[model samples]
Target: MEKDRRSLILDCAKELFATRGYHSTGISDIIEKAQVARGTFYLYFDSKRAVFDVLLESAFETILSSVKPVIVGPTPDRNNILKQLRINLGRALAPLFADRHLARIVVSQAETLDEVAAARMEAFYAALRHYLEESLQEGQEKHVIRQLNTKIVATAAVGMIKGIVWTHATGSESFDYHEVVEEIVEWAAMGIVTR
Candidate 1:
């Protein structure tokens, strides 16, 4: 089927990109790995960048879908906000845990590809920041959190999470995602300063 072939190409491309890095991987490489003809690859994607773009978009979609359920409905109160945050963190990390390749692409490699790719990465962060900002605003309204600059707070939170995820994905190894999530949520909700 056409869809299956396209997916096959994408799967092969993702594996190549993850293993070989985007710049090192070429169109021919993708086709060969996919076991598809050159013309078949052209039919599905115009170029390597095109395939990378699609992969990045798909990863973002997965992240958005993962986080949507936790934050979309009723606002959480003080008692439940921490629990909600934990759920949100767990869901956010699920895709990355499942696919380190996708995580590497989104977190580190995309921006290095080109200006358009960099902008796409920026937009991805913006989307995450927007979601965090909305949640923080809702928390403020509910008097669950202190009055703060939601934009700055959201940006910082997203940056922290991304930094940890990137390090875990690309660094030496032995990083536990649940521990990262737990520490991040604890710090985000309760500051380091002791009372």
Candidate 2:
């Protein structure tokens, strides 16, 4: 079936990209791995960049979808938001962090690619930014915590999470990720003040 073949190409491409790096991985490599002709790949995607877009966007979508309902649902409780973020983060970071080679260059490559990659990355990440902004707005409106700039806080929180992911993916530290995450949530929810 057409759908099955497309999926096959995508899966093969993901593996190749993650392992071989984007620039080093050629179109022929993907076709060879998929056992499909070069023309078949073109039918589904214009270039290697297209496959990268699909992979990155799908990863982002999975994380956003997993967390969207929990953030926007009836409960805007501060504790609930933290809990929901924690739950969804595992789903998002686990696979990506598990791959060292993939994580190293994945985020940075967007800026270096052609116009298509730049636009695709912008759209994907802009939506992510919007989601963060929305969740923070809801939390602030409910007086869940001290009033702060919601957009700034949301973007900062996302930045912190990325830092954690980068550290973990690079094997830079031996600290437990869950503990670091808890510390991150605590810091985000409440300023450090000795009780």
Give all TM-scores, in the order shown.
0.87, 0.73
| Predicted candidate 2 versus true structure: per-residue lDDT over 1-195, tens digit per residue | 999999998888877776666788999999999999988999999988788878777766665665644443564455666777667666666655665544544465554566877787567666767776776666556555456676776677777776776676556764475677678767865751111
* Candidate 2 clashing pairs, residues 3+ apart or interchain: none
Worst 10 residues of 1 by lDDT: 69-78
The residue-by-residue lDDT of candidate 1 on 15-96, one tens digit each, is 8888789999999999899899999999988989899989999888888877853342364444456667788788888888
- The models' CA-based lDDT, in order, is 0.80, 0.68
Q: What is the TM-score (0 to 1) of candidate 1?
A: 0.87
How many residue pairs clash in model 1?
Answer: 0
